[model samples]
Target: MIEEIQEQVAYYNARSQEYDEWFYRIGRYDRGLELNQCWFNEVDVLKSALQDIGEVNSILELACGTGIWTQELLKIGKEITALDASSEMIAINRKKLNDTKIVSYHQVDLFSWQPSKQYDLVFFSFWLSHVPPTQVDDFLAKVYRAVRPSGRVFIIDSCFEPSSTAKDHFFENENEIHQRRKLNNGQEYQIFKIYYQPNVLIDKLTQVGFQASVKQTNNYFIYAEGKKINKL
Candidate 1:
């Protein structure tokens, strides 16, 4: 497990250059124009949901990646602190932002990460799937502590749809917690990937003191929002 986690970090670091292509439905990730359009349409839905949560004064983003979500977050967050395990990912994110007046970057492993201070909103995109199944409880506990009471925790992750990945990759077995992913250059890596049903994620959040709700977009993505409400 330790070795696999390290490999996952290395995989993201190596794939950082082409990561945007995956999100944009370019290269091997394209599944024809209709499917590509559907992907973008759902992406808009996720973006809208993030924006609809309203503006926040302090925001913390985990596994922020190449600023795809960071750009949207900039509009709503008064101040932002972004964290990622890969320095390469952070480098791409910094370059894409082009300016950093409202943001700061930290390269840290999420598995062993601790929040120095809480925030009004904690957001992570396509990161929940990378949490190992055995470590999810501990990870959610960290998130529960990362947000202030009544603060929100929003998450975005991929569904089990095989088409969500590159055309050359084989995705199967929803019950499996591991996935083999191939980069554009044809290098492959085994990473932790656990797909969750809406109810399962909701229950996971609830276990750590969050009032949670989850939604799945057709066959592409699952997005969720949770609030940490103090119990009377």
Candidate 2:
């Protein structure tokens, strides 16, 4: 399991330079202008939902890739700590954010990294699906500890939409735990990718002592917002 997780980190590190291309709909990820418009539209939907959560004085973002959502969090959070396993990803993130004083970057493996302190919110984007099924409960427990009482947790992750990937890749069986991903250079890596249902995830979060609600974007993403109800 550790080896697999390390490979996942390596893949992200190697792909960091091209990561934003996927989000920007450029180069290999260009699906078409129409689909790209839909993508940003759904992204706006998620953004609006995050804004609706109201202001947070402090936020900790786990696996914050290249600061895409980190930039959004800055709008609502006075102070943000963004952590990822790959230093390369953090480098790009820092460059993108232009050394913002309001945000701190930490490069640490999420599986072994523990929070040094609690915050008003603990958030992660497109990261939960990368957690192996065996570690989901433990991971949420870590999130619970990182958030203050009455504080919130927000997560955004990919849905099983076939159009969400590059044109060259095909959607795999939903039940599969590992998926093969390729870089623009055609190098391949295996990573953990799980498609979680909103309701089922809500139940799991509830069992972990959260008052949670989850919603799906029209077709592309699943997002959840939960408030801590009790200590784990």
Q: Which tens-of-lDDT digit does each residue in 1-232 have in candidate 2? A: 9899989988999999999988888887888989889999999999999998888899999999999999999999999999998889999899989999999988888999887799999999889999999999999988988989899999899899888888888876887889889999899999999999988899888888789999998888899999999754
At residue 232, give the lDDT of candidate 2. 43
Which residues of candidate 2, in runs, are more than 4 Å off?
A: none
Give the number of the best model, judged by lDDT.
1
Count of residue pairs whose backbone atoms collide, per candidate: 0, 0
Candidate 1 at residue 151, lDDT?
98
lDDT of 2 at 211: 94
Tens-place lDDT digits, model 1, residues 1-232: 8999999998999999999999998899989999999999999999999999998999999999999999999999999999999999999999999968898999998999988899999999889899988899999989989999889999999999988888998876988999888987789899998899999999999999999999999889999999998866
Specify the poorest-scoring 10-residue window by lDDT in model 1.
Answer: 163-172
Off by over 4 Å in 1: none
Which candidate number would show the highest TM-score if scored against the true structure? Answer: 1
